[model samples]
Target: MSESEQLMVVDEAGQPLYTATRQDVHTQGLWHETFHCFVIDSIKQQVVLQQRADQKKDFPGMLDITAAGHLLAGESVADGVRELEEEIGLVKSFEELHGLGVYQEELRLPGFIDRERIHLFLTDSAKPLTGYSLQTTEVRRLLAFSFAEFARLAEEETTVLTTVEGETIQRNQFVPHPTDYWKTVYAGIKAYCER
Candidate 1:
């Protein structure tokens, strides 16, 4: 089934309520569960970011999470590991992921209201950017950025730039995740890297 047609376990303002189609959930501004993974290369102290496919209905052509997707109805958070492979072609087990806890996030677009109880995770990888096999329909390409530099960008109010894939990448180039969201991400990956 297409992602938009898939069944999602709905939440009413963070409380589990019922099941609805992905389309219904977003159009109605209902809450839903989502999985977000940040792939880090500890040896290189960098993290991978995927450029969403231009054809995507939401956030198309924008640099976003390393891998992320909504959880289907009846699926546990652990089941989200499939997204890692499906979106970026990195096969990994659930036990290999470091839990970063769940976060409440909401996005208000012109026609889309996305409220997600995001189950965040972090995983270490040493593979080069070329090692990833992009799911062309979902992700356009992957770029690696310095972990420390990314954290700085997330924590600071001023503009920060980092070289990614031979091009300069700044805060505006990414999806506008709230500052608190990025701080949680930075702290999670930083703690994981130090472990």
Candidate 2:
């Protein structure tokens, strides 16, 4: 859908308020729902990360969650699983995912006001990097990082020398999600992996 045509159900303090186009939502800093999924390889203790396509308007060429997108207006939260298939070609049903709970994140960047109620999910997979067929317009590449290192990375603002795909990743290269969001995600992933 085109930016102006893509509609989202905006909210106020997590309560649904009204519908707005994607452009309007961001431009106005309206609260909207988004889906985030973290693909983990339990056996290898690695977490999958996607490099955002440079053409992206926000945080282009940065590391981010495995797959994510805004929830369309009238779309059920469970329907968010489509993001997995759309971004990385990794298909799975909603039932197969482990819920990490919803999180609230906000950031004001220049003219963009981002206030989001995010539905986070986690799934452990043994799939290799080459197994993913990335949507080049949304994601540039996919790589796996040590799960332990990722957890540490989320805990603080320091950059760690983590090599993936023969390239080193620094904290500056990641989307600057709030510390609380990272903490919640880390806790959820830890609990899920331990289970």
Candidate 3:
């Protein structure tokens, strides 16, 4: 982890209070801003997901959003578009993303406390899975699954299978987030795809 990276610490109301090192932000339980980008291939009715690198400090080896990263202390939400290029090598303009609005999430564990205002965005990428230039240190592989299958899994149905780097994976391999969060994101992306 980069302890020297500066992050904007926010209050409970999501107002920026001050700047702190990334280490302090997590160690002190301070709220911060993060960007989440979900890629949907509307024509194929599939959503792209990424396997976090096994060496990642957080959620290592778990399936996660297509791309995500924290915004630096002086960065604007629009500036976060860089994360997609940096993490997954998908270079996209801010205008290409469909804004899904900001949401707050708080998770507390033994040694981690994350309180984040997530700025979500969606993009329709028709590129082949093999086209992505993976940042090996942050991402392991990319996978795609039918949006409908994901919806069923979100509803607690067992045995959702997805193809990851040519192999099949089960639902247990995914990051276990609240069902409501999954449903909300699914609904949002579905609506966007339909439009």
Candidate 4:
């Protein structure tokens, strides 16, 4: 229940249920949907990461995918292409996106158990980062990090991820995560980059 985000209903088997407030099914630990887009380098060795805006409901400004947003109610996963543009000002089409498989995971934090079905995609944009208009409320800053550096942060627990506006968030120990599902997304992207 982020005011900017939409809520949806789903079946017991995880199909679309209906749209509801975050307070409704959220208490029951059901899953939701999101769209993730990672902007990588030409060689695909680096990823453009965004710090979440300080105003977000979760994680806020911690290191996250290149660009991500909730899939609004009644929206298609394909619509995420537009979200990437609207949120980050990167106008592109599906061809630029290398659709990774949809991923599902559970998140535990601050008295909330968030289950999410994430639609992931990857693309390399040589576009200048400066030319983009940022959705300041959703992203505060952008940084490009090397895969090696990201690995070191996660492995060594050295990198302290904060929202683009500089709000820190404590993470779960059992998952060994840096920021939410970063480790999972990074592992997948790193594997993709290596090959």
lDDT of each: 0.84, 0.85, 0.85, 0.67
Residue-wise C-alpha lDDT for candidate 4, range 31-82, written one tens digit per residue: 7787888887756466677767788766775656667766778888888788
Error of 3 at 5 (Å): 1.1
**Best-fitting candidate, measured by TM-score?**
2
Against the true structure, candidate 2 reaches a TM-score of 0.94
* Model 4 poorest 10 in a row by lDDT: 171-180
Cα RMSD (Å) per model?
Answer: 1.9, 1.6, 1.9, 4.7
In model 4, the clashing pairs are 9-17, 9-18, 10-17, 52-61, 61-162, 61-163
Residue 54 CA displacement from its true place in model 2, Å: 1.1
How high is each candidate's TM-score?
0.92, 0.94, 0.91, 0.76
| Model 4 root-mean-square deviation | 4.7
**Candidate 1, after superposition: displacement of residue 188 in Å?**
0.7
* lDDT preference between candidates 3 and 4, better one: 3
Candidate 2 per-residue lDDT, tens place, 34-129, comes to 999999888888889899999998999998999999888888889999999999999999999999888988899998998888999998789999
Q: Summarize candidate 3's per-residue lDDT along 1-195 as a digit string, tens digits.
A: 487899999876778999999988887788999999998898888889999999998889999899999999889999989889988999999999999888788777778788888898989999988999999999999888888766765677766575533466777788776676677789888889777
Model 2 poorest 10 in a row by lDDT: 157-166
Model 2 ranges off by over 4 Å = 164-166
